[model samples]
Target: MEKVRVLVVDDSALVRKLLSAMLDSDPGIEVVGVAADPLIARDKIKQLNPDVLTLDVEMPRMDGLTFLENLMRLRPMPVVMVSSLTERGAEVTLRALEIGAVDFFTKPSSDLANCFAESAQEICAKVKMAARTRPRPYTQVQKIDVPPRLSADAVLPRSQSPGTRGSTRIIAVGASTGGTEAIRVLLEAMPPDAPPIVITQHIPAAFSGPFATRMNNCSAMRVCEARDGQPIQPGHAYIAPGGEHLLVMWDGAKHVCRLHDGPQVNRHKPSVDVLFRSTAASIGAAAIGVLLTGMGDDGARGLLEMRENGAPTLVQDEASSVVWGMPGAAWKLGAADEKLPLEDIAARLLVLAQQPIAGARRAAS
Candidate 1:
């Protein structure tokens, strides 16, 4: 098998060296060269013609985002951003993603060496996944090796009975990899009065609030990072805050949002499985489960549970997905009721939400 060639670009010599070492540790990856800044990276990219590029957000000669914009416009290829875990870093990194970068990871605020070493596995995995993706021109947009993972059972137990019925319907969404943009596109098309939407997108704690704010700016529905005990209501979308799992629970009168700061499920905090399973247990047939583009099978089992409980479930088709791992896994497991393109998902969701809950239950029966 051919090794995935990589170029490490960071202003810090230490960061570049650390990143290069991380990529080199993976047998499937080869670090072709290292650049201290985007100017050097530009030349190395031309010379090395690497399959993937690891870029830093801040650079001396040219900023990472500016270079990224140029690269996407001129010669689009997969690029993974290494950014800081700060409010400014989150804002800039989000812009890079919108400008067509494949994915991003935040560098630790302190103890750089130990933190980078600990996250080496995930860093290399993201590079490997980036190489396989077909990056688009100024259009937006993983961890590779599957280590032992804990399932939703780690946080929430599987419900033995069908979900309790509710008067109104809810939508459960899960995505990763290229999810930020996918979620944006889906939300942008929704009407102001759309059904309540609860989302789980793999993200770091600092980025979640900004991501929700960004989504709110684009979407007709009000989008905010979910709060514990918050009522689930129409015309609003709740985003699972980073580092915490978002779940739905019956509040006697209606379904309400619940946040769990528990162990990582499926190697992810705010895991898709936790949210989907919670929706399955709390709303049952009164909910719709939509699995979008992501790198792992985190949401597959939970989506299957939702389907088993008679909720309409759909996945973004491969052609429209940046990475099909999550949706593909769900489809292979017979979890989804339909596989639709990204352009059609919002319309289909609206239709499904309008369907009677009893009709969904009877169909499942």
Candidate 2:
């Protein structure tokens, strides 16, 4: 097996030593070089051409974000950010994902021994994943710092069209990485009478409750972490809570969100696959499955199963995703029924609800 080459970039000499020692300890990984900052990294890149770069968010001479933006534009490759587990750290880390970093790890400040140990393992695994990711070329463009101004209908109204005909509709959404913000944006656009939405996002226990609370306040949809035996009612959004698998159970009369503590499928406890499989088996032809921004193939096959079972499924297009791994995998596997950019997804979703179940053809434009 070819060893994955990695370059470590950090301002702290101790961190450089620690990360170097940890990553180098992995038999599958080879530490190609080390650098203190982006300037030094640029030189090392020229010399070593490492397969992966583990970067510290805060470094002397320049912050990681600026360096990342420049690097992606000039020489795009796999870059995993090491961030502090703080509010500011999370915020910047989110920005790095959006800017095209392949993965991230919170620099363990509390238990240096355990954290660094875990980070080393995670870094090697991520480097392996990164080696397989075909990075897009860096492009220079002006930031649309301003979002398109949305209408009351676009931003605030319920998703149900006024005088809309009756159609059995269920929404299934999945995401990872910067999904918290993306979920907020997409759900907040719906009206009070929107169709029931189900979401499976990879999140931590510390964040999901707050994330659910945050979602409930933003959308008219009654968003909550799913519990066993909880009925899935119209005008509600059920989120698969962190650290548990969420599946759907249906009777001819109604459907319910079923939470389980089963072993993780595809290495994710609350997997997109488990949720999607249940959706396919129960909801069948009556659901709209969505594959959103994420970082793996966990949901791809399940979404295909959903499509085969008659649920029309959509994937987030590469142009809009933070990391297109999940959606791209689905598209490649012939699982996705359609692909749409992030901003247009909600608008198109309403149309999917109204379309006929038979002759399931996708209009990708």
TM-scores of the candidates in the order shown: 0.95, 0.67
Candidate 2 deviant stretches above 4 angstroms: 1-15, 25-79, 83-102, 107-121, 125-167, 177-185, 213-222, 251-253, 356-365
Q: In angstroms, how far off is 65's CA in candidate 1?
A: 0.9
Worst 10 contiguous positions by lDDT, candidate 2: 155-164
- Model 1 scores a C-alpha lDDT of 0.91
Model 2 over residues 1-365: C-alpha lDDT tens digits?
Answer: 88889999999888888788777777777888999998999999989999999899988898999999999999998887887766567667666765778767777576666667644544566777776665555502212223332221221122221111124578888887546656877888877778889899887554466668778988988899887888887888998887887777664457787787766567676888877877776666678899887777778877887788778899989887766889999999999979998888888888887777542232111
Clashing pairs in 2: 157-191, 158-191, 158-192, 159-191
lDDT of 1 by residue, 210-329 (tens): 999999999999999999999999999999999999999988777899999989999999899999999998888889999999998999999999999889999999998989999999
* Candidate 1 residue-wise lDDT at 75: 94
The deviation in Å at residue 356 for candidate 2 is 4.9
RMSD of each: 4.0, 11.5
TM-score of 1: 0.95
Error of 2 at 328 (Å): 2.5
* lDDT, model 1, position 317: 98
